[model samples]
Target: SDTLTDQQKKCVAPNVYSLAQAYLNSEQAWPRAIYLGETPIGFIMLDIDPEDIDKKENAYYLWRFMIARDYQGKGYGKKALDLIIDKCKEDQKSVLYTSCDMEEEMPYRFYMNYGFTDTGVFDDDEKVLKLQLI
Candidate 1:
């Protein structure tokens, strides 16, 4: 299937079925996907206070976030971000940060529009951004 390559399909089959259980049971970090009805729309893996990942003072990482091809351009990305931000606010977290490939125009602008400031670049092609919550 175009959604997943053969090797990826095989590798992720079990994890897909146990996604929720794994996410909820995880002791280290949050790795989750957002769904629309029964369809998986996107995934977000984050850490509340990750160690070793260098960041500005008082910031946490929203490590990975990706919307599926069919779900792109539908504003679901913004909604997912809103959900995450709301959760952070509820938990009294002060700052949130993420990194995106600089070559990708949409995500870079999206983060900027949503109030993230470009802090620096890393991984040769990724730009890091930050948002401070009040």
Candidate 2:
């Protein structure tokens, strides 16, 4: 997350920023590395309520996710996201929310391609997307 391109930086915040935020909300923000064998390939952060059996709309969020510059386009992003989706299912979450800038370089299409739909919501200037999970 730290070594992303300038274009990518405009989309996702640095891992340090996400980690510090995670520190502030340790109960809800979950941060982890996307590792390939012994190497760290990416970073992911989730804002989730593991106890949300009722599956509220705000119960789960894909807070931050990024693949390193060199790691992008190598199938790591989708694979890492699958892991995140699995985690949400394990936590009994029925919906996953995420926000992205509306820029062309942003990850709106990627999330949409993965079944996330626009929710007509915005977190500041970022547009929110939702995925309904089975």
Candidate 3:
């Protein structure tokens, strides 16, 4: 349960911050543990009701996502994202939004490869990306 910059390893906030935010925003959060067999490899949290959060419109938001360094580049992230998308579709959501830093360690390209397009907006300094789920 590391904070935002645990050991200066990754750009994304660690599970501790994400999960804590999820707990505090329980009414709109949908946090899940990404597992490999029985072992937890990463964490993802979605703001299912984004309009209630920082979003200005009604949509789903990819609040936080990260896989441990040892588990990176092994298809775990893609699989976890697929599951997140499926969950949103299941709930009748049409759009999903997320933002990422321009830094090399960020998931910008990862999300782009998954069909997320830049919204030409910024959530703080993070560039916003969006995907259509419907």
* Over 4 Å off, model 1: 4-25, 53-56, 121-124
- Model 1, 1-134: lDDT tens digits are 35533433332233354455447646646777789989887777677666745544555578666666677778988999999998888877788878776553657888899899998756446677889897
Q: Tens-digit lDDT track for model 3 on 37-112? A: 9998888888887763455454788988888777888898999999888888887777889988878745888989
Task: Indicate the worst ten consecutive residues by lDDT in candidate 1.
Answer: 6-15
TM-score ranking of the models: 2, 3, 1
Which pairs clash in the backbone of model 3? none
Is 2 or 3 the stronger prediction by lDDT? 2
Query: Candidate 3: minimum summed lDDT over ten consecutive residues — where?
Result: 1-10
Candidate 3 lDDT at 101 equals 84
Clashing residue pairs found in predicted model 2:
none
What shift in Å separates residue 15 of candidate 3 from its native position after superposition?
1.2
Provide the TM-score for each candidate, comma-separated.
0.74, 0.89, 0.86
User: Which predicted model would earn the best TM-score?
Assistant: 2
